[model samples]
Target: MNKLIEREKITFHKVKPDPSSLEFGKYFTDYMFVMDYEEGMGWYHPRIAPYAPLTLDPSASVFHYGQAVFEGLKAYRTEDGRVLLFRPDQNIKRLNRSCERMSMPPLDEVLVLEALTQLVELEKDWVPKEKGTSLYIRPFVIATEPSLGVKASKSYTFMIVLSPVGSYYGDDQLKPVRIYVEDEYVRAVNGGVGNAKTSGNYAASLQAQRKANDLGYDQVLWLDAIEKKYVEEVGSMNIFFVINGEAVTPALSGSILSGITRASAIELIRSWGIPVREERISIDEIYTASARGELTEVFGTGTAAVVTPVGELNIHGKTVIVGDGQIGGISKKLYESITDIQLGKVKGPVNWTVEV
Candidate 1:
């Protein structure tokens, strides 16, 4: 692992907000970890410094061609004062995958993990202890070479920032959300960068999301690009449904993100002897199942919300209610199980929670 150099000047401050009133990504800690990359020298000069705005050239490649990637995870403060991270290594691996897809230099996983641990430890006091609250970590890489070309840049910057956040949806009740099924403006297609956690994919999704919001829906349910019939994912999470006592999600067909939370939920559900299947699920089949009373529950999984129950889905102008328009038993169970494991309330699989 590359040794991280510590800056001599230290800035100590605190942002102790009422945990119950915390908003996602609104506030930041006092310090940030950063590293740089060059074409021939590779990554160098890793350090943790006071949080500040970056000075980049107007012609930076990231500003023009949008060569960037990011990853999100959380750190929880256990009741006994232990700072625990949930599946951080998996997030790092996915970040590397995103780097490769975006043509950016891959990060040294061990060194990055070491840097993350050091930064989080230094700012451990910023971790919130209230229920449904934790420290959100955002790591991102952006191409920095100043050029107007359409090719990948020779310079880049990687940085990690932290925020003490409450629930992503701002609801202690874990209320079910209404989703609008989008049949137009496809999010991504097969053989594209859909699976990569890059900025462009999200930028391309803003229009549809705005439309959903304007229509009084909480999120948009995306469909496959070609047929536009099969379900792909929700606006910011992976979608799952319980039909006929079986748990099912759309398989990763090179066009959907393989979410860490989604994988963990699948594992936890399967461990309970419940049937789980990953396959292409069409929207027509879901509507038919709802009509026949076979669609019992609908939920989404991601690092942000963990598990979001889908109470209603609007297809074009038609609306279908899911599981009596409330949180299903399976949704509640999965949410509780994952949150418990994350907060260190329950012992999870070995190495699932890493100490800061």
Candidate 2:
């Protein structure tokens, strides 16, 4: 669409690794898409070049001020030899929203989508056909202007790279995980960049995540910055609860990432004639519900894991087992349903999958 992304000749190619042995985000494809933005020249010079390292100035704004944003989505190779992308348009739209929030130049959604499709098509051979493997696409923008001032940079670099990844879970089995309820550290505030997929928000989460890991937990469950009582999100996914037969998740209170998978899960569950509500759910309420044996299940949703069952939640020093400390029926159903749609095994909602 944008002048047919210029491709550099590939002199050599990397050998494909064993899909079962693949680790998440460890192996990259042969090519990548890149574009640049200037203060007055706008975004230009879109190209598809050989995957290589980037050279940036020492004082680049991104390194100094951390004005960067990124998005993640996967490309799947179906059994029929078709390449499918799940809701790529939504991912591109969210990328632009993150750009706007970080004071970076907004990309043309149509152009971005076209570039992504082209890149994935060029690297179609790298898309794993294994049962739990897919191509992980990372599209990001970084402020490139070499300056130290605490302000937005005048230039930026937008790029997309693809990695063939195995299943996000370490084990082949989809086992439930233990989560540490984080009250001492805050991931974001009402006026912060929590809603945006920026680097700082994640960097700020490392301390709590490390503490959780030290305490033998798989992930940290964050709470609201203001009240420090309401549940926000898990380490990298949106948290959900099935209390008294109703699906519940924290409302988007300007401090929570509006996850696409979270929204899709809600829609799919509601389509089954079940009730799903987006509202404030405090930690105390969850504990109380578990105490009363009313909390049936707890799960998390994200592009990485798709659906992760929360077997145990450690609030402060008290731990509560959820649904026999095993993967709930709802969690397994949602995981299978979403994976089915992604792999083209079953038809999903209209326009949910875009063929590459």
Q: Candidate 1: minimum summed lDDT over ten consecutive residues — where?
A: 1-10
lDDT of 1: 0.93
For each candidate, what TM-score against the reference? Answer: 0.98, 0.99
Tens-digit lDDT track of model 1 for 95-206: 9999999999999999889989888998899999987889999999999999998899999999999999998888644799999999988999998999999999999999
* Number of backbone-clashing residue pairs for each candidate, in the order shown: 0, 0
Q: Evaluate model 2: give its TM-score.
A: 0.99
Error (Å) of candidate 2 at residue 204 is: 0.6
RMSD of 1: 1.3
Q: Write down the worst ten-residue block by lDDT for model 2.
A: 1-10
